[model samples]
Target: MDVDLVVPGLYCLRPEFGQAYLWLDGRSATLVDTGIVGSGPAITALLTELDADLDRIVITHGHQDHAGSAAELRAATGAPVLAHAGDAAAIRGERPMPPPVLLDWERPLFDSIASNVPPNPPCPVDQEIAEGDVLDFGGGARVLSIPGHTDGSVAIHLPRSEVLFAGDTIANVDELMLGVFNVDRAKAIESFRRLAELGTEIACFGHGDPLIGDAGAKLRAAAAKITG
Candidate 1:
């Protein structure tokens, strides 16, 4: 388990293969993403140690790596689960995501991670979010619907903090890169462009190290290359 406070009140938790984040505001917190199966306990313990209240679990999408432990975490902390309606079914385990259209290089990495992910059971979604929805937590995070990584993929932007929790819509794997294994490539690119326009100072990605300081410039450059 890799646990570190990326910002004053934002902590990143990496367990085995995927990442989850804990966002703190005063005494309350919101958990973004839930790593592979069996990660709830670790997250609960982390919040307890820090004396932060677990207010809710906000899933970026329905991918198992992101929503796998939502049920468990909700049970542990009594936090509601929020997700985009387009991905609610998958998050609830009603259906499987479409097969990803991978580049040659992406396949190996995908396989390596997928093979280790345990089967995820159905999880409940207490709220369905969409574009322009504002979660009034941690000084209010505005939801930007940056679909393409998945139909309902969303990023949470905190205007007060100038921080963007970019959930797999973009990554920083070598530099800023479009997330691999997207269900819709074109939508993914469009989402990237939308994110580039946000101009945030800090970006937290689902994979790779978080980029602090002028993260928007990096995203804009990447977006321009794709659009041009």
Candidate 2:
């Protein structure tokens, strides 16, 4: 419920199917991921509350829930969208990969639905991130290419706050195991293992709640489960 004031400089914009995070670094702001299609209104409401102008939308991946509303956000704010090149197709709904979950019979049925889900027009990205590359979003916030969840999945790291916006490239992907959705099982696990080494104090996961207090310890435990 009101994650806006609680999160302070950044707030959560929970749209249908997915959630978007907003951070204000002064007059300009940065949004991490755009929710699924029809999320334009949620974003607008969040921005209005923050009273900030969005300068950029940083996509963590290309999945529909993450990029489906990218074009809309760009149109509304004229902000530049930046994503990884490997996931360009997914963002465009070109080589869209269906979630490898759902009941056995639901796969094919969902495939057809996948073809019909409205693809948000398209927006040319202003930048393509590569592994190890860091994007200084002014102030001390930066973006890191964490990959794994998708070939191009990225995470936003705020060293000043010791908070990392880890986008599904995590160890215990509880959602995937519960048959929510997943793309590459192996890659996702590997990405989680890598983060275990980050020793971040607080982790802002894309889903669920933030990992606070002993995140490094909890993440290590999750990493162990992945290895097993």
Candidate 3:
């Protein structure tokens, strides 16, 4: 795992398949997402090296790559896992994950990677979060319910810092674009537009490099080109 500093108190943890972020507030830290399974030890080590204790673990959605190590990390650090109620059941293994309605072009890619993706163990969500909830991290991170990547997808916005943790609602894989593999493309597009309007200067995404400056303008530009 590679740790990249996004700012003075923010660090992005890049694992092999996905990314997780660490937000520090003095000696306490909040984890935005937990990368795929087997990422617990690395993350725990990182926290120890930084001398920051994990205060909370927030899941943007119920996807395996995003929430896979949540349970493990929670166990190791004793941090409560919080997730949206809409996806809590799925994350807890009460129900199977809802499959994405793949676009024609996405099918081939999805098929190629699906088998290699490990199944996430059932994780217990200690708190059920929702839109408008302000989490005690990054100077009060506000949760914006941005469904369509999954019914419980969300983006964490920190107005004080002008930063947004856009969890798969938008991606910067090659360039800024809407996230693919969605259950509802239209809803995802709407969510993407909503995030673009936040006007944040910095944006962090789940699958790509963080947008450090003028992120809102870039998002708006990308959003304008996205047609239903």
Candidate 4:
């Protein structure tokens, strides 16, 4: 596991699979997306080093990589877990995750990685969030319901800080591209475009390195090339 500073008060935690972001607000912190299972200890250590208390655990979606350690972390820190209502059941283990509608080219890649991802245990969500809801972190994070990656996928936009936490709607692997493995590709594309319209200076993604400057323009350029 590796932790890197993304901005003044934000840090990105990279584990073996997926990424988790830590946002510091005073002595309290908000964690966005918990890496795959067994990632809890490393994250807890980092928070301890910073002398920060866990304020909340926000799961971008119900995917295992994103919500895997949510239960463990919440249990350890006594922090509330938040997720979109659309995926609440899946996160709570009341239902199965909606399978992605993989494209022909995505088959091999998905098959290769799917087996490596550990199954996420059921986690309880203390808050069910939706579009337009302002979470009390990062100067009020506006929840933009950007579904399609999963029925409940969301992008958290901090208009005050001009930073956007794009869950899996977008990725920056080798470059800025639309995230793959979507249950609804068309809706994901639309959501991508909507996120591009936001005015942001920095964009943190669930994978790859984040765009630190002029992120809005980069997102727009990438969005312009994508078609449903």
Candidate 5:
């Protein structure tokens, strides 16, 4: 329910398992992740608080919790959906993702929820992105590909502000759920090391509260455990 963590223009809506972010650049806002199916009202409330029209909705990955409301939100906002090509199939609900590597206990729970995510009605992708690609919002906000959480995972890195919207490639230290359920444990760790190199000051993850203060130290610590 902690919807607004305003930092100049970034606001966060706490969604279950994963969270969504609203980047207000001007009269329009760039929404990253639409949250789970039961998140429509909370998302709507975020828009109300921002007072900015959702210009475009960006899906960081294809998981249900990250993209559940995409089609519905698009209808309401008339905003285009942008995602990487790799996991587009999963997003469109054509094929469910492979189970997380090394985690057997959580498969049933994930499969159950993923089945209900509802295929996002195959919308033509307005833009297909790859790593290091820059997506502009008139001012300065770029969507950088970090991958690994899924083949198509991405992070919205506002270089000008040194803020990164780390989709699920990496979450906060407290995210026990993902600790037990990552599709590729090694790659996810690699992705985290990659983000660590970016020198991002504030990293807002999809599944937990944003990482604040000396993020480099925290990231390196996480990377060490993985490397070890």
Candidate 6:
């Protein structure tokens, strides 16, 4: 994994498959996601290189790839961990991986990814957020409760910057598309539509390169395709 500055304060920690982001703010920063197990050391190293102390570790959902290192990082930094209430138990490792309804072609890929994530012990969630909740980070980021990838999946929007931290709700891996292998595809599509309506100039995804310009339009196109 390597770290690259995507924007002035947004740094993308690009991992092989999954990704994590650091929102830099002087000496303190907020981590959007934690990559799979054994990713903690690298993440901390990057944080040190940036001279940023971890202020909070915010999880976008319960998926192992997205939250695997949350406990380790939280303990390492003494930072509170936050996630949506619906997936808090799963993020804490109290619940099994949500069974996904997937296409035949996606089954093998999904299984391979699932097999690689080591089981993590329970991690306490310091706070549970929901839609309309505004976190005191990056000036302020509004939480959009977008369920589909996982029941508590969310997108964090920085209106002041027109940036959307779009977890797995929407992906730009090969193209702008809705999250694949969802537990609830319909709900995921609905969430995609909601996210499309947001005016975003930059979009950060959990599994792909970020879209840096006119992201809202791309999201709208993806939503329309999904809906149609």
Backbone atom clashes (below 3 Å) for every candidate = 1, 0, 0, 0, 0, 0
> Candidate 4 lDDT, tens digit per residue, 1-228?
999998888999999899989999988899999999999999999999999999999999999899999999999999999999999999999999999999999999999989999988999999999999999998899999998999999999999999999999999999888999999999999999999999999999998899999999999999999877
RMSD of 6: 1.3
lDDT of 4 at 86: 91
- Give residue 31's lDDT in candidate 4 (0 to 100): 97
| Candidate 6 local lDDT, 95-182, one digit each (tens) | 8767888978889998898787676557889999999999988889999999988899988999989999989888877788887889
For all candidates in order, the CA lDDT equals 0.86, 0.68, 0.93, 0.94, 0.72, 0.87
Tell me, by lDDT, which candidate is best: 4
Q: Sort by lDDT, best first: what order? A: 4, 3, 6, 1, 5, 2
Whichever of 3 and 5 has more lDDT, that candidate is: 3
Clashing pairs in 3: none
Candidate 4 residue 121 Cα shift, in angstroms, is 0.6
Model 5 alpha-carbon miss at residue 65, Å: 0.7
Per-residue CA lDDT of model 2 for 6-72, tens digit only, reads 2557666666555567777766688888877878767866777767888888888877767888988
**Candidate 6, run of 10 with poorest lDDT:** 113-122
Q: Which ranges in model 4 have alpha carbons more than 4 Å from their true place?
A: none
- Candidate 1 — which residues are off by over 4 angstroms? none
Candidate 5 segments exceeding 4 Å error:
104-124, 173-180
Cα lDDT tens digits for candidate 1, 1-228: 779889798888998767888898887988999988888888888888899888889999878788889989988889999999888888888887767888789899989878878877799899999888989786779988887888888899999898998999888788788888988788899888888898699889898888889988888988888741
Which 10-residue window in model 1 sums to the lowest lDDT? Answer: 219-228
Error of 6 at 39 (Å): 0.9
210: Cα error in model 1, Å: 0.7
RMSD of each: 1.4, 3.8, 0.7, 0.6, 2.9, 1.3
